[model samples]
Target: MDSVRTCVACRKRASRTELLRVVVHEGRLVADDRAVLPGRGAWVHPTARCLDRAVSRGSFPRALRVSGKPDAGPIENRLKTLMDN
Candidate 1:
């Protein structure tokens, strides 16, 4: 069976495959499409609404247990790409 994860942004539980996994890499947020990145990952829906909510509420750092603010540009770009496809 697929694992379950919670969206840090919406605070809703869903299957891991239904959410996007994000990790902090070099102080920046990166999308873990393969779910193979090293470090703690925070899951959120791929939709822009969830992404905006996550960023506005400061859920990334808290969920990933990182210090200060990690850059969200990379993940934002990734989400845009996903939306385009």
Candidate 2:
């Protein structure tokens, strides 16, 4: 059976495969395309608006259970790059 995850920004529930998984790597947010990275993770829709909400609302840190704010650029760039490819 498929699992479900909620977007930390929008708080909408969806199938895990439908949302992008993100994790903090080296104190920065990065997308887990294969969802294989160890440690804490949060799911979000792969859209700039969703990403912006996640950043503006400052939910990443709480969702990832980490202290301090992490940069959101890398995650956004990764999504854009994925869309472009």
Candidate 3:
């Protein structure tokens, strides 16, 4: 059977492959494209809406089990690049 995960923002379960993995590194949030990052991670749909929801709801730090707000600039820039291409 395929693995499943819940989106931190939407709180919906989905096939693991259908979601993007995010992790906190150096107190910043980054997309884990390979899903092999070494840390507590959060999964989310790879869309701006989901990303925005996660951010606006302040879910990143909680999902990632970290204190304070983690920088999501990297993820935003990556998403922008993907949209542009």
Candidate 4:
């Protein structure tokens, strides 16, 4: 079975493969569908609003438990990229 994971914004548990895992990588945050990264991770809906919520509320820093040098421009671009497809 696919591992179950939760979306921090929606508070909904979903299959790991069904949700996007956001991680901090080398002082930057990126979404990893591959689920491979060091340190902690957070999940958000694969939608723009949920992603916006996660970024706006500082959830990534809280979940990863690090002070964020948030590159939200990249994040927003990534979400837009996904939504465009």
Candidate 5:
């Protein structure tokens, strides 16, 4: 069976393949498309709406169990690229 995960922004439960995995790396938020990154991960829908909501609500730090906010620029850029394709 497919694993399940909750989207940090929307707070909706969905299959792991249906969400994008995000992890903190080098003080920045990185999207793990292959879901193979080390460390704790927070899942979110790969869309601008979810990304914006998560960032605006400061969900990453809490969900990832991090202290401060990690730079979200990298993930934002990644979402943009994904949307363009």
Candidate 6:
């Protein structure tokens, strides 16, 4: 069986490999390509819709336990890049 991790955006449990790994470092959200980041990490579906839902719903910010709204800039840009290439 695969390991499970709760999505930072959806607050739902999902397979670790099935979700994208995002890490908050230096107070900035960054996409962790290798899924190896020292600080707290957040999970989200690889799909654009999920990422959007996460951002608009405040799930990302709540899951990360950080104040202020997450602009979803990194997630959005990553999804866009994936679709473009």
Candidate with maximal TM-score: 1
- Over 4 Å off, model 2: none
Candidate 3 — worst ten consecutive residues by lDDT sum?
A: 76-85
lDDT of 4 by residue, 1-85 (tens): 7888888877789998778888877777788878887668888878988887877788778877888456766667888999899
User: TM-score of every model?
Assistant: 0.97, 0.93, 0.93, 0.87, 0.97, 0.79
Task: Name the TM-score of candidate 4.
Answer: 0.87
- lDDT value, residue 53 of candidate 4: 81
Local distance difference test values of all predictions, in order: 0.97, 0.92, 0.90, 0.80, 0.97, 0.76
Which ranking of candidates, highest TM-score first? 1, 5, 2, 3, 4, 6
Candidate 2 structure quality by residue, lDDT tens digits, 1-85 = 9999999999999999989999999989999989999999999999888899999998999999999999888998898997797
Tens-digit lDDT string for candidate 6 (1-85)? 8889887665789998888887666666678878887866778888887787777787766777888875567767878898789
TM-score computed on alpha carbons, candidate 1: 0.97
RMSD of 3: 1.0
Q: Between 3 and 6, whose lDDT is larger? A: 3
Off by over 4 Å in 5: none
Number of backbone-clashing residue pairs for each candidate, in the order shown: 0, 0, 0, 0, 0, 0
Model 5, range 1-85, lDDT digits (tens) per residue?
A: 9999999999999999999999999999999989999999999999999999999999999999999889999999999999999
Better of 2 and 4 by lDDT: 2
Kindly report the root-mean-square deviation of model 4 from the true structure over all alpha carbons. Answer: 1.4
Candidate 1 lDDT over 5-80, as tens digits, reads 9999999999999999999999999999899989999999999999999999999999999999999999999999
Tell me the alpha-carbon RMSD of every candidate: 0.6, 1.0, 1.0, 1.4, 0.6, 2.0
- Candidate 2's displacement at residue 13, Å, is 0.3
| Pairs of residues clashing in candidate 2 | none
TM-score of candidate 3 on Cα atoms, chains taken together: 0.93
